[model samples]
Target: MSQPYLAPAELTAEFCGRLLDALDAPLALDHVCVDFQAVKSLDSSAVALLLEWHRRAQAAQRQLELMHLPSALSQLIKVYGVEEFLQIKA
Candidate 1:
């Protein structure tokens, strides 16, 4: 598996393109994890990005795990009703 992806501090719509671009790179691993420890801010767009990444991972026949998710973000994910889909790590 590849090293966990470190998320940017500011997870907003402005960074979506760059984040998506990074994901566009070919990943040979069967499982991937995104570390959210560095992320201090998040918005609906961030949630959308995560969902998109999960979709891409599924399409690629890989598993996506979100690690070290902040409480705020976790709450947001629950609010958005996607905790099961995102498979957030404890």
Candidate 2:
């Protein structure tokens, strides 16, 4: 398997595009893992970006797994009722 995509310390609107761009090259893989352990802060925009990435993965018939999500971000995703879609790792 390929190495997990490491999220930046900050996943705000300004940095999400860079992450997305980085992902473009890896979408061909059957499975993709995004490591969120380093993310110290994120707004709703980060959630949107994640959802978009999920959508892209689905469209490509790929699997997207989000790993080591920070507690705050996990709560945000739960609040939005999208944990299933985001596939947050335990």
Candidate 3:
């Protein structure tokens, strides 16, 4: 939930450059929800960010749910064979 949605004119480049802005008490939160609907495009950077969050949450014994993931983003994740790792909850 800390990641911001900065929709730049360049759809391909549009992204939330800062991925940990609101993670002050990440360990205290029961869950971390990331809304990816506004992400028109996704790339390796997105995957990396997701993985990082997943790892952190797992290490802290917390949960991370990715909501409204775009079809393209989902496809990318599947293509990368990281669906299991994402553990995308409804």
Q: Which candidate's lDDT is highest?
A: 2
- Considering TM-score, which of the candidate structures 2 and 3 is the better prediction for this target? 2
Candidate 3 local lDDT, residue 43? 71
Best by TM-score: 2
**Clashing residue pairs, candidate 2?**
none
Query: Model 3, range 44-65, lDDT digits (tens) per residue?
Result: 6666666777788788787777
- Model 3 Cα RMSD, 1 decimal: 4.3
lDDT of 3: 0.62
Q: What is the overall TM-score of model 2 with all chains considered together? A: 0.86
lDDT tens readout by residue for model 2, 13-81: 888877776676687865888898899889877888889999888888888878888888778888898
lDDT string for model 1 (24-68, tens) is 453445578788899988788888888889889888888877788
Backbone collisions counted per model? 0, 0, 0
Q: For model 1, what is the alpha-carbon lDDT of residue 11?
A: 88
Tell me each candidate's TM-score: 0.86, 0.86, 0.68
Total backbone clashes of candidate 3, pairs 3 or more residues apart or in separate chains:
0
| Candidate 1 residue 64 C-alpha distance from true site, Å | 0.8
Please give the ranking of all candidate structures by TM-score, highest first, separated by commas: 2, 1, 3
